[model samples]
Target: MAQTSASPDVATRALPATWTTNLHLSSDTGLLQEGLDALEGYRKKDPNKVVVRFRAIGNAPIMRQNFYKITVSNRFQAVIQFLRKELGWKAGEPLYTYINMAFSPAPDDTVSNLFKSFATDGHLIVNYSTTAAWG
Candidate 1:
């Protein structure tokens, strides 16, 4: 289909001088400051490798080498898979892993973020159990 284009004269027309001059302005500077603070809070500088300490919960078997170092860019699922391999757990078996015995991070959560938020004494404590051990 043939399309008609705007005339050169019409295309070059400028907007009214007052159109941009009278634009609404916000008087609340506090909101802008809060937004800046929030942005600063969200940014976290991560290291190349994160130290992960695996701890047994309840009747779960303990890993001989509790401390394992992994790249910061890895996701939480990689940690879970490594634990399962060490414990010889099948794919369908129930494995509950938590950070600092507090909460379970999502599979897609980055190791760097988890380490940044929950690492203690330069190690990220990961608790594991065959069943639910904590709320």
Candidate 2:
């Protein structure tokens, strides 16, 4: 059998035994700490209250004032249900809502977390439409 030689670069290169540990420590520790701090703050928020402003889209009817102060512990579903009732929508009728005209959140998501992440100018701008809107 003929012998094969490894490339010079490959032969000279050696893997560090503690590469994983070094990588873990070196990978954006400051950003990681900031993220952890944000998470801690999210988890430790007091009162857990958020203010929301609802805006009608397209042909949707406007609400009176349309601003509400809600508890952060409430799920997104409560907002939907409130809207449906306010608009006198039948149970089977479809309604769509989005945050900051960006995206719709899950019904089970907490209002506090959503407010912390998406609220602007001291209020969460909730856009609603009777037809399908943004994803």
Candidate 3:
């Protein structure tokens, strides 16, 4: 089959003016600004006063209750230290901690920030195990 070029009249025909006007109006609207404001509100929360809940997993020993609260501003290392002291594990003993049983966070990461990003039902569910659950 031979190729044919479009007629000049058809090629010059423009999109309906209503469609162009609608596109320009939508782009100029402040929807993006509104979305950014909402996101800023969500991320600007106060982590210092947030309380995160810790729960033991597997055969890991429990100190008092099934769950306990810690301030969000505290470093993840504090939780590790507390668990070690509570379990009475030797200095060389190993313990593992994770959030939602998904992944372990860095020791320097702030508890409140983690809680803010991952908490469910207003509680940050932390799982601790004596053996490594994930690499």
Worst 10 residues of 1 by lDDT: 1-10
Task: Encode model 2's per-residue lDDT on 38-64: one tens digit a residue.
Answer: 899867645656789999999899998
Q: Judged by lDDT, which candidate is best? A: 1
Per-residue CA lDDT of candidate 1, range 1-135, in tens? 212554655567755768555345756688679879999976655558978999999999988899999988889999999999999999899999999988999999999989888899999999999999775
TM-score of each: 0.65, 0.65, 0.59
lDDT of 3 by residue, 23-132 (tens): 55547448779878889987664545554566777888776754656766688898788777777889878789999989999999988778778988987777888888
Candidate 1: residue 130 lDDT (0-100): 90
lDDT of 2 at 128: 96
lDDT of 1 at 27: 67
Model 1, position 103, has a per-residue lDDT of: 94
Question: What is candidate 3's TM-score against the reference?
Answer: 0.59
Model 1 backbone overlap count: 0
lDDT of 1: 0.87
Q: For candidate 2, which ten residues in a row score worst on lDDT?
A: 1-10
Question: Which is the better candidate, 1 or 3, if ranked by lDDT?
Answer: 1
